[model samples]
Target: MAGKFEISRRSNGEFQFNLKAGNGQVILTSEGYSARSSCENGIESVRRNSADDARFQRKTSSNGKHYFTLTATNGQVIGSSEMYADASGRDNGIRSVQDNAPAAAITDLTAA
Candidate 1:
């Protein structure tokens, strides 16, 4: 299976998305957007920014977990990743986003 973007509604009624790898692992996730269109735009931002290494912000939490945020050209955080146990794992997550986001198909799971 190819990587895919899974769009869904949050419990608070906001829209969010997850970028999953071909093996069905979620490499990246989006912030909640008040509108579905904004959520979709976030996906586009991920696609556009994933290819640029500089667009990814790699950071370590105070608790020592590692994560990454995909930033748009305008400096907005378009997407983020789940915490990883190590920096290498976080780096791998960034690479997964870079490799999969460009061609991932959308799988809309939101209610019609």
Candidate 2:
């Protein structure tokens, strides 16, 4: 199965999206946007930026958990990964986003 982008509305009335891998694991999550269109644009940005390794910024949380953020060319963060127990897991998440995002289908859960 191919990966997919799932867009949904937040409780605060904003919009966000998740990039799910083929196995349905969420590889990356976007920041909340004030509008659905902005959220959609974020998704497109992920698809465009995921192709570049340098766009992925790997980091360690203050507590030492590993994670990564995907950034656009303008240096804006497009999405981030969930905290992982180790750098290897965080790296795998980045790889998953790169391998899956470009061709991922979009599923708009916000549809009424």
Candidate 3:
């Protein structure tokens, strides 16, 4: 099945990209991005790729649930959230978190 992509700006004023597969079933997401290009890059990469990835700034456990966090290069906590399980959950949650941020600008498809 073909996948879908969504882009937005986060509450913390960062860029984010979301990917959905299986006809609207979200499959992967990216953390709060510091730049618009980065977010779009992430989204496009997900569209062309098949792997699932979660880039967390910190790993912690709280309230009987595991929490994942994403930080900007400047040390700001742009995105912080929790996940129920392992990689899959974390990856989806990451995208869920991305929903609040602005969509990164799309890049050149031919660029290397």
Top candidate (TM-score): 2
Better of 2 and 3 by TM-score: 2
Angstrom error of the Cα, residue 56, model 2: value is: 0.3
lDDT of 1 at 63: 100
User: Candidate 1 residues 2-110, lDDT tens each?
Assistant: 8999999999999999999999999998999999899999999899889999999999999999999999999988888999999999999999898999999999999
In order, candidate lDDTs are 0.93, 0.96, 0.51
Q: Show model 2 residue runs off by greater than 4 Å.
A: none
Model 1 — which ten-residue stretch has the worst lDDT? 103-112
Best by lDDT: 2
Total clashes for model 3? 10
* Per-residue lDDT of candidate 2, residues 1-112 (tens digit): 9999999989998999999999999999999999989999999999999999999999999999999999999999999999999999999999999999999999999998
TM-score of each candidate structure, all chains considered together: 0.96, 0.98, 0.42
Better of 1 and 2 by TM-score: 2
- In model 2, the Cα lDDT at residue 70 comes to 97
Model 3 lDDT per residue over 1-112, tens place: 4444566677897767555443555434468778877766665544332222333453646555555655444443433454556656755665553442333233232233
- Rank by lDDT (best first): 2, 1, 3
**Backbone clash pairs in model 2 (N, Cα, C under 3 Å; residues 3+ apart or in different chains), count:** 0
> TM-score for model 3?
0.42
